[model samples]
Target: MRKLRIGIVGTGYVTDCHYKAFKQNRNAVISGMCHTYNLSHPKYREKQESLKKKCKGFDIKAYNDFNELVSDPSIDAIIISSTNSLHFEHIVAAINNGKHVLADMPVVTDIKQLAAIEKLSEEKGISIFPAHNFVYNEAMKKVKALIEDGRIGQIIHASFLSSHSISNNHLLGWNPNSELSKGEAMFDSGHHLIYQCLYLLGKPVKISSFKSKTILKSMDCEDTMQLSMQFVNGAMAVLMQSWSKDHSKMINGIRILGTYGSIVLTDALYFNDKKIMKMNDYMESFVRLSKAFSDNILKKVPPLSDLNAVHEILEITSNLYKTAEIESLRII
Candidate 1:
């Protein structure tokens, strides 16, 4: 009945969501948090205080120095929720520190870093679980079962659209250099679509994509991205993600198409779709993943998103970015 001590690297908005989820898990404890940036910033400090207050029984220390958090002997696992660019270094340090890691999605923007982490995790005998929370969605899980059980026989073709407004300020906050933001949409939003695609159709053999900055004049990252994947199993998937869409009336969603039936999950895929599946909101997907990781740490079960699947998703994403870049050249 020992609690799993978890250290989180990053104190951003998404990290706060993670913190809240960790607090809800009775089997997990938020041991500490690290942020290399200005933790003294009012919003950042406020979030730290809020988390501390919320996780009253947990020992949550806020550190400006990430190394200090990584070096903490009390931390049994680390969650890498840092920015896309810093994921490689942070994850490496966590792995070397001999802690199980739950890395946020788009694990690393670069293929080299992704491969290195895969190798390092194997060498260290520590597990690295990517935060592809979609796979744990009750509806998606049901859909997966339906497909597997022949309720949806032979998944023919599928499409996914994840659109949201990435305000100018938000883009600037992440990448001061406009060009860098222009390049990260695929890494940011495309990762989710690709992960879902892999979950449904297995690994893709060839991926072709078109990415461009369609709007948001000040932002350099491509606000729009369209990817077409040809899975090794002969199933094809088309994925589109955009940051320029009008979010006032719009929301994110996915559709899985099969010969017998189709499944649709919208509005972050957890809340909206859970009701459709007649499930409770208490069943958060990250909580499931956290429990799964805890079980794996206790040697009770294997990691839910195994290394091979993680590698395949990372590879597909990296390749899609490359394809997008090539397509960009052809367009020019």
Candidate 2:
């Protein structure tokens, strides 16, 4: 079969990551590009020029309009890597134009949007793959395999931890605004653990969560969060994320304890106190996902990350936030 002609919409950092990943895929070729960059920003012209130059160097067609990009008959799929607010609109346009979509995380803002997108996808015979890249990394794959093979036996408890800092400028978007950021943290930075828990331990039966502003007090959301879950299979998980103590010395990762052995996942995977496999770069996760997206399309198989998974994740996240509390803002 011929290569999948993937058209991309957006030129942000994630979009660049997707661009490079697709460039490495053997079964797909990036056919065109459309950007949602701010036309009023002072740097807009510079950014556009740079994006066009990059597209020209990569032999990808640059579309001035997103609609034209989606309507292009030669493009088989479109990636909705645009801003979070624009995701739904881009997704609808792509599906309407008979193009499959690979959307960034938090695929839709709410349950209603998700339902509508799902229905439209079904009606159009188009697929919308979620970009849950963290779980698609090499180490996570090994972690999943080990659990299936009983190397880790029955998981008893686990801890998933991550820490990274965000700048004030980055929060100038919707992140800091209470009206715009409600439940955003659950699927933005905290989304990985939710899906990873489901991927490893199955459905969670109970959930409790708390957050703290700490360093990001200017934002209405938390800079630190601790979420606890109890799975139907009797497994438990604690997910912790902090944006405060983001020094280079902070070693962030996942720790899983099982009946037989244990696993620790970071820049590597450790099984039974021994290092098993080194984790690939975070960007490599994007590469692996991009290749799978193309191969899945070519083979007529389901994507690694799909809307059903997103639905489950979103449901769990909703429950987590319902009872979440601000434990504290300033830590002594």
Q: Which one is best on TM-score?
A: 2
Off by over 4 Å in 1: 38-59, 167-169, 175-182, 232-234, 247-251, 267-283, 327-332
Clashing pairs in 2: none
Tens-digit per-residue lDDT, 113-208, candidate 2: 899999999999888888888778878988989999998788899988888887665577566775544444555777787777778777778888
lDDT of 1 at 119: 88
TM-score of 1: 0.82
Instruction: State the weakest 10-residue window (summed lDDT) of model 2.
Output: 178-187
For every candidate in turn, the CA RMSD to the true structure comes to 4.5, 3.1
Compared with the true structure, what per-residue lDDT tens digits does model 1 show for residues 1-332? 77998888766666766776777777888778766454556676665565556445345676646777888888899998876677788889989999888888767666677789888989998888778776776667766776778766777777878877766657657753533332566667667777777776777677898877777666655778888877666777888888777672344566666776666666433321334454324337767767666767776586545656767866776677677777344454
lDDT of 2 at 177: 70
